[model samples]
Target: MPHLTIEYSPNLGDFPEADMALALNASVCASPEVKDESDLKTRFVRTRHFQIGTADTPRAFVHAQLRLLAGRSPKAKQDLSERIAAVLRRMAPRPDGTLVQLSVEIVDMDRPSYVKESLG
Candidate 1:
């Protein structure tokens, strides 16, 4: 099970937020290994501002975190991370030259209390 959470600056309007969520969810569900759509959950959070290094950039910065169940092999994790980053870059291209930080974390469901809830 993997839970994908996308947190971005509120500069992105409702339409962009909804579009990004759908794109990310589709990317994850498109994974060959993911059998059930219900197993994939995506949440989007829009913040007022996000500090990047010392300077606060006006451009919106998108950070994505994908938390997966523990049993997945290291190779799978790396592949998933690459796929997620690729999808984000394709979806959230920067108007400016600033970079979008995409982070991926794979958590073990056994050691942690990660639950697989419906994506309703």
Candidate 2:
């Protein structure tokens, strides 16, 4: 299972969260580490209270977190992370006078404790 979460500043000015999620989902699906694209899920959360560097200047940031089942090699994770970072950098809003910071992180889910039950 791969879950992608995007946390970003609210002041970014009408960001297209839905489209961004779709693009990221595609990016995740492109990774060789992922088994299935249908299982990929992505969501975005806007943060209203946050400071970057100096409070006086208008600074923004987007942080992407990807969680997947454990057992992938370090190279696989790094590849996925780099792909995601590229997508984020390309999609993130660049408001005229604001400095935006982009970052990506990959998290591993413990296979022993992780559980999933689907009902369809």
Can you write out model 1's per-residue Cα lDDT over 4-109, one digit (the tens) per residue?
Answer: 8777765544426678777777877887757787777788777765676777555556777787667778887777777777777777755555555655555556
- Residue 101 lDDT in candidate 2: 91
Off by over 4 Å in 1: 12-15, 56-60, 97-99, 111-120
Model 1 Cα shift for residue 86 (angstroms): 1.3
Reference-based lDDT, residue 3, model 2: 86
On TM-score, the candidate that comes out on top is: 2
Model 2 clash pairs? none
Q: Rate the local accuracy (lDDT) of all candidates.
A: 0.69, 0.88
TM-score of 2: 0.93
